[model samples]
Target chain A: SAVISQKPSRDICQRGTSLTIQCQVDSQVTMMFWYRQQPGQSLTLIATANQGSEATYESGFVIDKFPISRPNLTFSTLTVSNMSPEDSSIYLCSVGQGTEKLFFGSGTQLSVL
Target chain B: AQTVTQSQPEMSVQEAETVTLSCTYDTSESDYYLFWYKQPPSRQMILVIRQEAYKQQNATENRFSVNFQKAAKSFSLKISDSQLGDAAMYFCAYRRVNSGYALNFGKGTSLLVTP
Candidate 1:
């Protein structure tokens, strides 16, 4: 199992401000992903972060809103741009070595005011 | 596209009792994986158990076990000796064999374990 550390466990920001969440993995991983979960809702895939390429955004999500950076195998970041109350959700970072199971971080709880 | 379904929105069980949460999924692929994740008040998603589609034998972890019915596309989790700590929201997920590690999650079932 991979251990992931997510910074800014939580934050409250003014509307229209951008917040960046960071995820660090204890070990190098090949695949990293970002997900969003609304309060009392299921997890929604936001994007897949590739080490050296642009992230792949899922349907209903756009790169302009959630920009991702995977500088290396051990780290990745997700930025929630132009935030709004609707952008308030728990952001999760997951790492997978291959087609195996994914390990998730504690998640960053964001609240837009 | 694959979808996971957890029909029970909420369920309750007494401490030391057994409880089962139902889950069904839709997938055209023959090889895949299923997982059950528990999220407590802390909001950390914890893996409870997982089942491989090609495996006929069920998977068990301590008091957590799963009933994987491949033909029926059903995977249910059974918690034996339920404890207060078992109270949490459980999500069912599916991952295709060929697809990258992205998992499709169900709405989730809130389980309450009471003494």
Candidate 2:
């Protein structure tokens, strides 16, 4: 089991601004993923953050909009740049070991006005 | 690509009663995993139960259990003696085993426990 702490549990930001959400894990995980969830919607995978290598983003997502950095095994950060009203959503970080089950962080809620 | 579907948008159950949340998924791969996650008012996601595709028997955890139908590509979560704390949004997710891909999630079903 891994304990993930996400900072800025909830934040209200202005449009065009950027917000960086931090995720810290208690143990070294084999893989870490970032996800976004709109209000009342299912979770969407944003990117997969791996140590040493650059983050692998999913389709419809770009690095210029969402930049991710995994400095170490236990820490990672995701920045939502040039936020728009549509960018308002809850971002979550998840980690998986060898099991199929993945543990998630509490999530960071960002509201763009 | 994998996709998950949860037919019911909202469901209600009386306190201490049993409730089942239905879910179905489409995947080309034969080996995969299914999971049920709970999200409370706080919006924190929590795992409720999980089932491996190869496992023939159902998976049970405490009062929570799953009915995994591999042939039908259906996985449902059953909560026995539902409590107030059990009232929340439930999501069904699917992922391929050993694929290292992101999980595919359903829209979710909101469960409301009535007094």
Q: What is the TM-score of chain A, computed separately for every candidate? A: 0.97, 0.98
Q: Write the per-residue lDDT of candidate 1 for residues A1-113, one digit (tens) a residue.
A: 89999988999999999999999999999899999999889999999999999999999999899999999999999999999999999999998864387889999999999
Docking quality class, candidate 1: medium
Candidate 1 CA-lDDT value: 0.94
Residues A28-95, model 2: lDDT tens digits: 98789999999889999999998999999999999999999998999999999999999999999999
**What is the Cα-based lDDT of residue A47 in candidate 1?**
94
Q: Is the docking of candidate 2 incorrect, acceptable, medium or high quality?
A: medium
Which sections of candidate 1 miss by over 4 Å? none
- What's the distance in Å from true for residue B47, model 2? 1.0
Q: What are the Cα lDDT values of the candidates?
A: 0.94, 0.93
Clashing pairs in 2: none
